[model samples]
Target: MDSTEVVVRSVRTVGPDTVALILESPPEFDARPGQFLQVAGEVDGEEIARHYTLSSPGADETFEMTVGIDPDGDLSPWLGEREQGDTLEVAGPFGRSYYEDEPRVVVLAGGPGVGPAVGIAERAMADGGEAVVVYRDDEPAHEDRLRGLEAAGATVLVTDEPLADSDDALDVLSEATGQVFVYGFADFLDDANDALAATGHDPDDAKVENFG
Candidate 1:
């Protein structure tokens, strides 16, 4: 756990169900894409831990995480209540970074899943690889941030494609040559795999990251 204590610099609402948790990074913090922070705090007399995807691109000094509101959730509520100048504990950069310099990869994300996708795309962009991203039902506040993500050279697609009755996300995802990286609802992975396998897409190429 390459952990540190971060001071809460600001908190901004990104959508009805999401908020951007901005923190002042510790000195000499260097985190790669796909890594996460396990924030530990007390909520309602329980030892609570929530893993948040960092949104601060590159090795920036300001660490930020995109959090979705869970009405029945224990941690996000407390996290949402945090004001500027507060402090939070985080430990991480504790996983594999998104593939760098890989062939054309399809980034499939839903809601908060976009952060890691963008991080991966950023890494690919840095390595000069072709990357495409697809988002489903993005947070309203994040629309502006996401719409221009692809305009900076990467291809980004946003769709209302149903993960159930429609295979649109699947079709768009398969258009990429090499790989598909997906993150979001558990059922999304199942539906994606089912669609891919049914359509004869190579299941080996796409990697699924399910966080349940």
Candidate 2:
């Protein structure tokens, strides 16, 4: 992976236990929606690396990553404490699943998985394609951005319950014909896959990105 030094421009809270890190865009640093960066910084005199999905579309001159801080984790706590002007090493625009010029897309996300799912929806809308984002969270993160996506011709569904329980799940899948993206923890992914199967769509056909 190619490494670049980037200076943190700002760090702001996006939701409870979540933050958006705005960093100076490195030269030629272009990443697709759903791709991640291997970010490294020194913590307690030891270098630690963590992968964070790029939450911003590639159109921006700055790089934005929305991170969910884990209080018990070594890297996340340090990342949450990062301030403006701090320098961190970043590498790769890695990941296979991303937005394309498909006619229709279904993005299913849970919890912090909203980061890349929203990014894909934004890019899809910008490309004049239809995007349906079905997000499951009690306290939805990136509510503002999701609303913006709705205003931009993307369908946004927020459910406080499981995706299978959502009344619109099967209807949404029926309309989705192109690519399907699913992001969440392992169990959430499994549930989503089961939901997809129940809707008569092949679960294996969807691109999945799993988290902890």
Most lDDT-accurate candidate:
2
Instruction: State each candidate's clash count.
Output: 0, 0
Model 2 clash pairs? Answer: none
Candidate 1, superposed: residue stretches over 4 Å from native: 101-103, 138-141, 163-168, 198-200
The positional error of residue 45 in candidate 1, measured at the CA in angstroms, is 4.2
* Clash count, predicted structure 1: 0
TM agreement with the true structure for every prediction:
0.84, 0.93
- Measured on C-alpha atoms, candidate 1 has an lDDT of 0.71
Q: Each candidate: what lDDT?
A: 0.71, 0.84
| Tens-digit lDDT track of model 2 for 131-181 | 989888887888889999988888788887777766687677666666889
